[model samples]
Target: MFFATTALALLIERFIGYPDILVRTIGHPVQWIGAFIAWLDARLNPESEPGNRLAGMLALLALLVVTGGLALAVALALRKLPYGWVAEAIIATPFLAQKSLAGHVRAVADGLDRSLAEGRSAVSRIVGRDPEQLDRSGVARAALESLGENASDGIVAPAFWLALLGLPGIALYKAINTADSMIGHRSPRYLAFGWAAARLDDLVNLPCARLTGLLFALAAYFSSRTSAKAAFAAMRRDAHRHVSPNAGWPESALAGALGVKLGGPRAYGGRHVDLATMGDGKSELDANDIRDGLSLYGDALSLLAVIAVLLALAF
Candidate 1:
């Protein structure tokens, strides 16, 4: 049941994606989760505290209970209806983002095809660093890095949780991720207050991050242009060098597969982050590299779907 629900939801999201109209109408689930997190942040998070840590933990607890409870309620209600698993799958579609990730990455390449300025503009929409600071290669690298990291965060992790625990599992995972995005910062304001959220996000992402990397490696193995050996070597050698415990796996895998270097100096919120480079390849990436990265992403996404379907059949 879990595997079938996951497979159905992935297939549905792969085709239609969550529409902007739907997002604009009521708002996306992540936005809703963000709103609730904000409320908790305001009420529970004090400016100064020997209590912010406890407060943050309480906020996280509340978020999990509410999110899981509501999703479980909806799943139960839908199950009472005919073809309820189908309905659950539809409801779960918005949580997984395969098509949209590809779209964003493709838009970077499209923008670069027009002009460098337009490329910077398009990449800015998806990345956090100042777009004005990036050259052509920087823009391409940013897009690929975003594609790699978000593949795990936005799609694989949620799907993993969904297959493990159905609707409530996926919902809980998203809640954690959204909270981490909103409050799990290293900034002074969020530092102590967001400790629990950040740590928990890391814990939950463990399995899926590595899984996403392996999937990308398999994708590379199947492709003539990319190198599976490089991907695997990078994972073993450079993945741990990344600041993020989870993000490095896919980012390094994709970097090696594409034969491009990723991760270096970047500015964010006026602060410079001296990040370690992932792949021992050429740093001069162009728009075409971004397209190649998207091809790799598509292959990985297909592999994930195939795995889910096979698991469904096996169990």
Candidate 2:
């Protein structure tokens, strides 16, 4: 199932690519599916209790199955509809955004080089951190950090799950990720309720995150700015140091791959958050550095697509 889905997805990605209208159309159905799932969740468990945890878990599992089936059904349904393979390909293409990912990262650097305010506004769309006080270097780092983390969340993780489990797998992963983003927080009210969602999201991301590092390293080897060997070594040494077991893998690899330091101190919600810096070289980052990071990141994704193609062929 994984092989077939990945093969078809990769082919669609290579040929038709992502179209804005296609992405927008996908959102309509995904929203309806998500709303139906949420309604069911609320009706099944209205209040929090020890037993509710078990019930919620069961409900989520059932939801995963149902949503997965629906995604597959929708894909098949699309195939039989008008406009032939071109339209179906467009529908599948938005699900993977390899080219757009690199373009957006480049825009951040462009905005920062022009003006800090411009940089902040452009980056704020991509990151949750406050952008107002960010200096030139801070803007670059934030953009790079977002690239690292989102490479997993927005691209690789979805591909990984979908490849393994088909539309159902991707839908299940997205649903869980959405739940975590919505309520899987550490706030007082959600401490207990969001625990499962958070843990499950982490588990889903673990392997894909590590694979992200490996891809970055491969990209570094092909690029002129950095050394892939050093990137791999640094990833092995520094990946576990971050608070998130999964995030550190890609961030550390990207830091070593680009020869720039990332993941330092920052402010959030009026609170100081100290973070472990990845890589030991190049404390200062500029627009050129951001470009280098994006290029290497692009290479990493290219490597991922190639591997996905190869895997699909092999299996």
Candidate 3:
């Protein structure tokens, strides 16, 4: 039953995605979670507090209680309805984001064909870095990197949790993730207060990130444009190079698969961030590379669906 629910949600999200009208009408679940986090931050995360870390821990506990409880209530209520699994699947659909992620990444490639300024504008929407500082290669690399990282965060991780513990599982994961995105930074304001959110997000993402990397390697094995061996090897060799314990896995895999160097120095908010490079390949990235990355991403999703089906059949 869990497997069927996961597979159905994945397929539905892949084809139709979350509707824009629905998003505009009620906003996303993540946004709702973010609102709660914001409220907590304002009340509990003041910089002057001596016990900032303790406060952060308490805030995280509160968030978990609320999100997990709400999800459980929803799941239980849906079970009472006709075709309850279908209702559950519908509730789970917005959590996974395969089509939306691919579409946004593809838009960057499309924008690049028009002009460099347009390309920067498009990539800026998805990435956190300053777009004005990015050159043509930088913009393409940023888009591809976002694709790899979000493939884990937005798609694989959610599906993984949903398969394991149903609707409540995915809801819990997203709440942790949203907290990490909002407050889990190394900046002075967040360094202490956001510790629990950042660490917990990393812990949950660990397995899913590796799974996503392996799926990408499998996708490369079936593709003529990439080398599967190199992709896997690169992931093993360089996945730890990033500051993030999890993001490097998929990013390194995609870099080696596409024969492109990623993860060099980039700017975020007027500050230059010098990071380790992933692949020992060409650094000249362009629109075509972005298209190829998207294709590889699609192949990875297909492999994920097959795995979900197999798991369903087996368990």
Residues 1-315 of candidate 1: C-alpha lDDT, one tens digit per residue: 599899999999998999889988999998899999999998887565433788899999999999999999999999899899889999999899898889988999999989999999999988989998899999999999999999999999999999999999999999999999989998788888899999999999999999999999989988899999999999999999999999999999999998999999999977888999999999999999999999999999999999999998998
- Local distance difference test scores for all models: 0.93, 0.74, 0.93
Against the hidden true structure, what lDDT does model 1 obtain?
0.93
The TM-score values for the models, in the order shown, are: 0.97, 0.84, 0.97
Poorly placed runs, candidate 1 (over 4 Å): 46-51
Off by over 4 Å in 2: 14-18, 23-59, 72-92
- Number of clashes in model 3? 0
Q: For candidate 3, what is the lDDT?
A: 0.93
Question: What C-alpha lDDT, on a 0 to 100 scale, does residue 280 get in candidate 1?
Answer: 94
Clash counts per candidate, in order, are: 0, 1, 0
Model 3 error, position 41 (Å):
0.7
Q: What is the C-alpha RMSD of each candidate to the true structure, in Å?
A: 1.4, 3.7, 1.3
Model 3 lDDT tens row, 239-290: 9999899999999999999999999999999999899988888999999999
TM-score-best of 1 and 2: 1
| Model 3 segments more than 4 A misplaced | 47-51
Please give the range of 10 consecutive residues that has the lowest summed lDDT in model 2: 83-92
